[model samples]
Target chain A: MNRDTVIPPLNAIFQDVFDDPSLEVSDDMTAPDVEGWDSLSHVNLIVAVEKEFKIRLTTAEVRGLSNVGDFIALISRKAT
Target chain B: MIAQKTASLDYGRLVRESRKLRPDGAHQNIRVAILSDAASQQFVPLLKTLFHENCVNAEIYEGAFDAIELEALNPASGLYEFLPGVIVLANCTQALRSRYYEHKGDDFLETASQRVQRIWDALQRHSSARVIQCNYPLPYERQFGNYDLKVPQSLYSVTAELNSRIALYARQRSNALVCDVEAIASYLGRKHWFDERLWAFSKAFCHLDHLPYLAQSLVEMVLSSMGRVVKCVILDLDNTLWGGVVGDDGPLGIAIGPHGDGEAFYHFQQYILSLKKRGILLAVCSKNNRETAIQPFLENPDMVLKYEDITVFVANWENKAGNIRAIRDTLEIGLDSMVFLDDNPFERNLVRELLPGVIVPELPEDPADYVRAICELNLFETSSFSLEDTARSELYRQEAGRRELQTSFTSIDEYLQSLEMKIEVARFDPAAVPRIAQLIQRSNQFNLTTHRYNEAECETMMRDEANYLPLYARLSDRFGDHGLISVVILNVSAAEMEIRDWLMSCRVLARGVEQYLMTRVVAVALEKGVSRISGHYIPTAKNAMVKDFFAQFGFEKVLETDGGSRWHLDPTAYRPPTIYITEKQRTS
Candidate 1:
């Protein structure tokens, strides 16, 4: 799976987590961009993302992610 | 072997359903406040959905994460102002462990117990809400491994002691209850229950998948506290009560006993009998010939539930949904109080569509799984039980016989007189507090004020007789004893008495028990030099039968609100109604 394929589903998961349908995820978009994307809900988003992609990301990998692009890149790498 | 738990709502489904909750649909309203020393945002939605499914609209208040003490201890906190009927306090092992290990405290167990008790005491002082405290889950880290159980100061040993202390404390306090988080986790596999990943990420105590189960347990507690429990179990014959259709397979052919497939039905009957013993009325509504249905109960030596066990048995060609309605009318219970179980999908769907209030549980394909399926649902959740429960079936059976006998008389008055009813009215006794509290909790339909009280609260009222007049009445006739069936609590001031609570069992309705009690209460008031006696008739969806209760006995309506109407009577002008009954009391 490429970054393009992962972005749409990942966006849907993000929308569900923040309960905001209008939320759009891009490469530069970070936690601050979303209204409810705080430290408390960040891990829920991560778990939801992991469940969605059927891949388990290491703790270090989750902490290393800077933005949506990093998350998508890691997902694409792990999916292969 | 222990039965496998029924499938729980997945995280996604729970979220979707929670979002769809609306205030307009619920038949009842309850306020709940969930306070936890862990992230609690997720529990709010889960509880909302669960209670909504139970036809109870819940308004939930979630405390800030890791702020249980702050929310509970502060009188000015929003939790107190919410004035919740039920308050749930859940603390995770992770937080307690951090507190214990970080401080190197040897008195961790004692301190933890004190902290939990302190919160309970504060809540009691600040609010009248019933408290449900969740016990700590056993920590996953087995640092001391096998030696942990032997060491008193080990984390495992300390946590275990803390859990027991919490339970013991809740047992002593009438308003406090402990929810065993460890038990729930043990049943669901501790590894699956406590997701370290979720804990690391968001400080969540349990996995999101288990939220629905936890929420279900909490909602059940609330419903039982509110007296919204399932009171009757309605069963079907043919393939349901036994393995084969009784009409096709003769009495000897039906599989029910110690043999192969018969054992399943036998076990099912045993389970139903246990529920019957707990005072849950059992009824049989089936689509079969009366003889064929009656044959199994008479001939089959292996049958666990005999003919006498059933309160109402209707085996006919009529539609089951209509039969269930007849049962509800005859039993004088709400449709929500009955649970219908049938093997056929058609019958289940029909009852579900026609009588939506009736809880029609879907039967499993395998007969062996029947008992497990229903037990897992926790359809009948009760907080208190008494000797009266054991004899409940006999009372209902006698009532049925009385109903049959009533047809012989031309008038209702003559029928009531022929029954030869006698009542024993007395003040609240220490020994009968449990039954009185149970009556207060369970009496919904015939209740005037619908005021719920537990044993401890009832004891308090008994002690404070100067201000509270707590009276109870027991009924018996030529047939059998009805046990203690009515409760009335009056608030007495300098010159007036107000009825705080008035509820009676539906079994004694129209038996002139109400009129007798009212006369006795007025007599007591007049003896105390009270000028007037006032009473309330608060209306609920189930208590419509008692709407005109106060008016029927000559109490004039003084004030009417959206909730209910108030009625008052001048003791000087009151006259007791003439009825054929004898009254007795115990001086001690």
Candidate 2:
């Protein structure tokens, strides 16, 4: 695994996603923390994670993933 | 002879270890947005399990269709709030179809292809993500079919036509894949899909169990086939025992074999056997006394599958996952190679949570359907079955003997020497061109550099250039002769000798064939006075297994382009990995 790959899902999500490419990260952050992080963006992040893992996530799990850590735990759970 | 490895693997159940998912399931985030109705909430869990269950970092946002926030998806701006691999529009009615259909033009398949392409191209430009477009499900046939008159197409046909277009579109491109929602809905028998007990149906618009399962299945199949090969099918016995336990019921009493109730279970076993015949390995992981489970073979007259049929078995209940892991080891295959099918929902869920790579087929209430659904479910992948598929099961049985054959040896070299492996390196001849061409296209894992060629193409390339010299290597050892194990396409020009295509079958890897082939390249180049010999590495999702190939051969890196990596080997300084026996002839 590359060291650069260990970047938290959200930070990577933000950099790969958001228009505010200058987006920096802190764990305390939420989607609400950034601009343009609406419902579609939320789903877009889910798609990004699916692309990243080559695995699928359900809408409920996507909806239930509350924080960056929660998402991290969820993603790490599926990582081979 | 010990030389040939004839063990065949099911392309499915071949476990894929988590790597940086540049292509398949990536380790990063998959931007996903679901556009559906509040009605879809019930089915979301199943969808998530299907699509997101194994994915580590996916963020899915769902809302009423109007809530999609399409403004954020402008690709021309080259700016996006998110990048989604797949964007699904569900719970859509015919009215939505009209709008989508209006934009569709000319080749209906092309229309769907371009729509997906535009979305993928747009998403890819901004962030590395793909797209999946789901065709709206058909309304109940009773209602939708009655309205069509002039066009004479049923609503179901319309849905199918649309979905077919999408499937074709995705099939044509690597960057995008289509999600067949219409087909999924159709698979559910008419009454079952419209108003199931799990769903809370509104009089206005009917729906069935959760949308998540559908979404999840779509995502999972798409990702698995993106490159991962599912190689094996690991199954269990007990209450998963044909509706009766084998140990308790005894072989005769067990709910299996050609009879009512029993026939359902027996047919299920037969279905599994059919898969095995097609090269999907069938292994048993049960909790019966080893001898008792083994007895079914000898005593049970009605049984269609025998002890020899299965590749691996773990009868102890010591955690199904542990047994599954053991099976993976025994086969020298990967966890992804197996899909665990136990009638017990708990065991299924447990394995799903623990070893996520092992696909756990959903246990439906009816046992009769299990056998058939598994046979028909093409979701995970589609592949061209080769002639090798017919003999795969027996091939693995022989491989097991090879393993037992290993225990008798003390040292690795002794084991190799005992096999007395012999290799024949012959100049390419007209008679072998067809098979050689097939080898170039089919060879994957053991390939040092995978360069694909067709029979006619190989023939043309060979005759066209004095620079092109191709050779195929055939090997025979203790086990048997592996027809032709390797092929090399060389460009022998005076200025620069190049290795255009160099590939070897995975069966012969770790056997020092790379050294033999490289030495041939060096010797030929040296004689030609082509001071420089070069090779290239084209990065494919599966071929990443060979990135450091030339480096291992001591080739100096010359250039790295987005196309692939290039390397140079000085004709003067090169040594081959030679120890095995060899026979060679050079054609003028």
Residue-wise lDDT of candidate 2 within B376-431, one digit each (tens)?
Answer: 44523532356687677766755555555666899766666666667777667788
Encode model 1's per-residue lDDT on B1-588: one tens digit a residue.
011123356776677677777875536899999998778887887777777766678899988778888888999999998998899997888888889888655787778888988888899999999998988878877768999999998888989988888878877888987777888788778877877767777788787777667777777778888877787899998778888888888988999997788998988999999999989999999888888889989998888989989998889989988889888877788997789999999999999899988887878999899987886676777655679888777877787777767868999889888888888887798989999999999999999878899999999989997788899999988877888999999898557899999999987887889888888888888788988888888888899998988777778999999988989888888878977677755556
Poorest stretch of ten by lDDT in candidate 1 chain B: B1-10
**iRMSD per prediction, in order:** 2.0, 11.8
Chain A only: TM-score of every candidate?
0.93, 0.75
| Candidate 1 deviant stretches above 4 angstroms | B1-8, B16-22, B25-27, B103-106, B144-147, B150-152, B407-478, B482-588
The positional error of residue B38 in candidate 2, measured at the CA in angstroms, is 11
Error of 2 at B227 (Å): 5.5
Using all chains and alpha carbons, the TM-scores for the candidates as numbered come to 0.75, 0.53
